[model samples]
Target: MRHSFYCFALFSLLGAAALLGQDKTPPAKLVLKAKTGNVTYDHAAHAKREKNACPVCHPKLFTQDAKAPVAFKPPHKKHEDAKASCGSCHRAGGTAFETKGNCTNSKCHVKATERKG
Candidate 1:
């Protein structure tokens, strides 16, 4: 009984420490797909770009669910003006570069072909 009590106490302390060590940031990366190619958005880089402003995207541009279904339709103009849409900022002189600027640039995106081969 004494051994079991000690084990329980040790586990409790370990769990608490583990929780405390966790970061408050949601995640540093997310994979977004488009008809042209797949791109991994680096939240860490964007956080720096936005000067660590979470409100730039939270609850407005994106929900808490990182795995939410984001349909990237073509005829791209259709989505250019949609509320909180990626293109809203991905366009020229917004915040980030245009999506079609270059598929090889590592700053914004990496093509699936490049990611694999």
Candidate 2:
């Protein structure tokens, strides 16, 4: 009985410390699927930049509105398009979210180099 009591106290202290040490900001991005690209919208950064409340992206990308519990992992199973109802053009010819811009240049997520087959 005494051993269990001590264990409980230790667990409580650890839990409190973990909570205190956490950042007030939401930990991660509000990832959404779009036809152009699988968008990893940094919620913390976006909130800071836009100065908006949590509801702006909550219940969807943000965890504050989680209908189901989520962990530090990808939320959806399918690609961005089908999940969000974004048509194929979002990834292709000339809709909106094409990867043609930043991907091709050194700016955004440009690949290191092309390898020959």
Candidate 3:
């Protein structure tokens, strides 16, 4: 009976560790479709920029689920002033670049050309 208890305890500990490890692993990228074009958000790069601190944007600015809406709609000034969504950092004088003149041309939105067969 003692031997069985020890085995069960060890398995429980290992299972807990594995579950904890999964939360630390963020998705590499998330593609958000836009009217102009699709924006490929580099999750790994952003996480690296934040030193892998998940809380920096989780459960507040954004959620852990990628399928959820980003809530970064137009009339961006509203979100920017409120420091919400991507505007939290991409606004003018924010940590990252602003969205004013960076709409297209290798910026956030890039229209892809179709290839003819």
Candidate 4:
């Protein structure tokens, strides 16, 4: 019984850890699928980026087909040139509020050879 109790405690701790680390970021499926490059943009993590503001940048690069208010539409979209879309600004990178790397030189962008990987 003690072993079972320990297991439950361990799981609870892990659960809490996951929640703490979880990117509060909502689903970015719309923008994710629309991207043209192999770049993986973590919207949640990005939101946490200090100087980055979603409203300030998103609409300029992306377009709404329905002509409805963004609040009335889902946060993401599907199937389009993501780079030519939202990626345009993000491609250049931005100032970090709580993280590292310049917005333009960010890992998501960086001229091919400039990438850290």
Candidate 3, residues 19-52, lDDT tens digits: the string is 9877655679998999988888999999999998
Candidate with better lDDT, 1 vs 3: 3
Compose the digit string of candidate 4's lDDT tens values, residues 1-117. 999999999999999999999665455423322122234456556556535576654566534332322221122122121433443333334232211243244544333346676
Q: What 10-residue stretch in candidate 3 is worst by lDDT?
A: 18-27
- Specify the poorest-scoring 10-residue window by lDDT in model 4: 72-81
Candidate 4 regions with alpha-carbon error over 4 angstroms: 1-25, 28-37, 50-52, 63-106, 109-117
User: Which residue runs does candidate 1 get wrong by more than 4 Å?
Assistant: 1-24, 103-109, 113-117
Runs in model 3 lying further than 4 Å from the true structure: 1-24
lDDT of 3: 0.88
Error at 40, model 3, angstroms: 0.7
| lDDT of each candidate versus the true structure | 0.69, 0.47, 0.88, 0.43
Clashing pairs in 1: none
For model 2, residues 1-117, the per-residue Cα lDDT tens digits are 999999999999999999999766554665443333444545465567547765544544435642333322222223333433222223444344544344434322333356999
Q: Is candidate 1 or candidate 3 better by TM-score?
A: 3
TM-score (C-alpha, index-matched) for candidate 1: 0.59
Cα lDDT of model 1 by residue, 1-117, tens digit: 999999999999999999999776677889887655567877788778889888887767677677886544564455555633676686555566665655557754455553655
lDDT-superior candidate, 1 or 4 = 1
